[model samples]
Target: MIVVGIIGRPDSPWCHDATACLVVDGRVVVALEQERLSRRRFAPGEGPEETLRLLLAEQGLRPSDVDAIGYAWADATPEIARRVDSALPCGVLGTDRLTETVFPTLAAELRNKEIFFFDHHLCHAAQTYWFNPHRDADVLVADGTGGAGSTSLFRVRDGRFELLDRYSPLWSIGIFYEAAAFYAGLGWDAAGKLMGLSSYGRPSGRRFMTFDDGAGEFRLDPALRGLPSGGFTEERLAHEWTAIFEASAFPYAAGASNTFDYATFATDVQETVEDVGMALARRLRRRSGHDALLVAGGVALNAHLNRRLALESGYRRVSSTTAPHDGGAAIGAGLLAASVLGEPVRRRDPADPLPIFLGPAVGTAAIEAALDAESVPRQALEPEKLRAQVAEALDRGEIVAWFDGPIEVGPRALGARSLLSSPRSRTTLDRLNVIKGRAAWRPAALALTGAGFDAIDIEPAVAGLTEYMLCVHRVGERDWDRVATGVHVDGTTRAQHVADGSEFGALLGAVGRVSGLPGLINTSLNLRGRPMVLTPAHAVELFAEAPEVDLLVMPPYLVRRP
Candidate 1:
């Protein structure tokens, strides 16, 4: 049976989601976010209408072919969550709302097909475990607000999940971090930037946050909760954090002093998250008696904490997918619907997980069409010659926009839709960030061949499982200069180990052969504040806009600025 899974639309322009997924025969055949097609950063109030239409048409099936529908969120969001002043229109839908707007005729035809509403945190857990290699493990999910609360812990034994404990939104460490992001003036999506900035400052003795080990809950200082109730908005969050900061001994700073202050705040928050998460993982590991751990949620996106947990959690194995955030919930929702319908879920081996090349594929014809439509000058070369040209361009310190195969599934580029550059240059990071219009502090990652891991200080177990750009590893002193451009201020780098024999791996190998560099500095192929480019048209348009970008590698065609 074919099951379609979807996430609720973003409430406003600055928010994210509106991801549509189609899981056919228990495998996610297609998943796309509305922002990619709409060209708006996390396009608000948009449903999956266009994404669903394209995915179905590609498979020669219509909406009527779907047997069931699954929603990533639970039946309803908490009423307090509705009080926030969302920056965009609120057309985000759940299963009930979906039945009204998506595919009128298909709704009538598939009247017997059941509509399933998976709990939000459960969806996060399912996404991690269903495709995870571990058969029995402890699953931990931490996010901002989901249904009744924030944090959830579950024990998965032989393909089933048993809830061990849960915490309400009041104890949400994720929300606390979001407030910290707002305090840094980086906004909501800047959690990553917060993590990077943390490297620049030492942990402070503010002691405003703590975790209760016995209770297994987060305890925030009462002063941090500036709002009367739990209602949170960007403005409110900023105000609340400001009050807390003002009360501190080293109050808010002005001008350049603000950067140091923000960095200190980021460092304290990072340390707090680490302290709480590690304690929780250790306790859960002992209680569940599981050797492996599967983690999800937006907070799971913290690669630094992930690397630390992999080493210290006491579990023999730890696993997390690249899309641990809400976008991945579509995968979980799809798998859950498949189980309810009795379809066989794909069981990958513990060591060999599923490949994440799940986005829409672009063909040679489509590339040519986009180039022709845009009136861009281009060169067409054979595969081997094109690889050689790209490698040579990288060696010369030119940033190349590389597009190939299906786009990656998660927030990371993962070599599918990535910007490739020489990692040896000290200034490459700054230049790339400028070209992408991102803050200088946001870190770009590296795509390394397997052999390159030997140069970095990564644990054997963690390095062996480094398919996605999820965990951070310290760059060895000897190899620091080689990948310096991609390494963050903390001497750590989030690297995606390219698998042998894949097209992307071949390109990385070629770059290594030419420049003797450990890996290529790889980042998402889009400007800052934009979702990864979807179609060749989007890539072509981006190419036209960024003159600093040297070349656009679209399979057989390569376009250089005229």
Candidate 2:
């Protein structure tokens, strides 16, 4: 049965359902992003016409080929939520109103296939468990709030997934980090900026607030609904977030404070997060008596936290997928739909060698057309040639925008949709951010390649699992001078270790061979305050807008001419 799982919120820009995966005959097929074909970023509200068309055409799937449709979002968000009255500062947005848009759409789409509506958090839990390696792992769900729960906890037992608890998007860990990003004066959807910033400073009671007076725990806090009526305006959120930052961690040093807070704060933040995580991990470990813990949520992006949870937490095992955020929920919704229909569940172990090539694969023709349209210089660099040239650019300190392969599913730059450059020079770092029109202080990331990580001084667990640039790595003593600009103020670097032959790997080899640096300063291919560049057109427009970007490597073609 061709079951398409979709996840698009009401009033959101595009229908995310088109990218939904269907579990068929024990194989994971069907992972599409609405934007790739439609050429929009998070195109919410719009139908998945292009996706359905492309699916049917590319896979020889007809409309009738679809047996069922599963929505990642709740049919009615309210019906699923446990009415969170009196929200916390960063709690879920409007936990009170159910997303009523699900029903009418499901009913409409059902004419072609059986439509299934799932509770939002349940979908998140499904993602947690589906990606979990352990059969009976406890589940943790985290995201920007789905009606009520921005972050939630769950447990998997006896072939079933269950929720342990729920938390609102407000006072939410996601929002807290988000607020920190904003406080650092970064752009929207730029939590990475906070991670980068956190690398520069020590957590001096400024960026953290205790849950209890001296609980040593921190939460994104704001005023709750003091009245019987429960509702808070966006203005209120902005006001409260502003207050918290003013009262707490707003550094006022014009003398150029250490840009290394990310290390200390990330370390402290990771440690503090581990404190909460360890408490929860211990509780779940004791309650379930199962060694494995499955965590899903945007917070899962905290690699430093993840390392602590995996190494220090009480759980015997920890599992999270490369795409554990909202995007992966599309996969979960499909899995759930398959399960509910009495279809046999075939689990894909996260350990079974899963590389996150989840989104639509752009055709070479499309890429060529884009290159031709831009009249950019063209040449397919053989592995060695490209490597040497790219290395030369890096050694010379050029900011190159790298877009290769299928776009990664989640909200990370990864190596697929990254910008590359020199991390060694303060001038290069400043130029890159200025090119991005982002905060001048924001640090760039490094995409390492091969097994040469030991040669570069960095904290353990960082250079190893940097396949995705999710976690912050501690820069070691020797590499500090080289990666100073790339390393956050706190001395941590978000690194993506690329395998030897992949696009990222090749790029790394090139840079390493030339400059003796494993990778370039990495960042997404997007302007500040925008989503990553999703297509050739996006790349073209972006380069046109920001002329300083020296080159764009789209494989077989490079864009350097205006």
TM-score winner = 1
lDDT of 1 at 256: 32
Q: What is candidate 2's lDDT per residue for 192-288, written digit by digit as tens?
A: 5556555455554422432331332334324322211125433355445545545544342211244343344433443445455555555556556
Candidate 1 off by > 4 Å? 9-15, 77-98, 101-113, 221-242, 253-257, 350-353, 455-465
Model 1 pairs in collision = 12-88
Reference-based lDDT, each prediction: 0.74, 0.61
lDDT by residue for model 1 over 165-218, one digit each (tens)? 787766666777776776676776577878888899877655566667567766
Candidate 2 residue-wise lDDT at 162: 57
Q: What lDDT, from 0 to 1, does candidate 1 have? A: 0.74
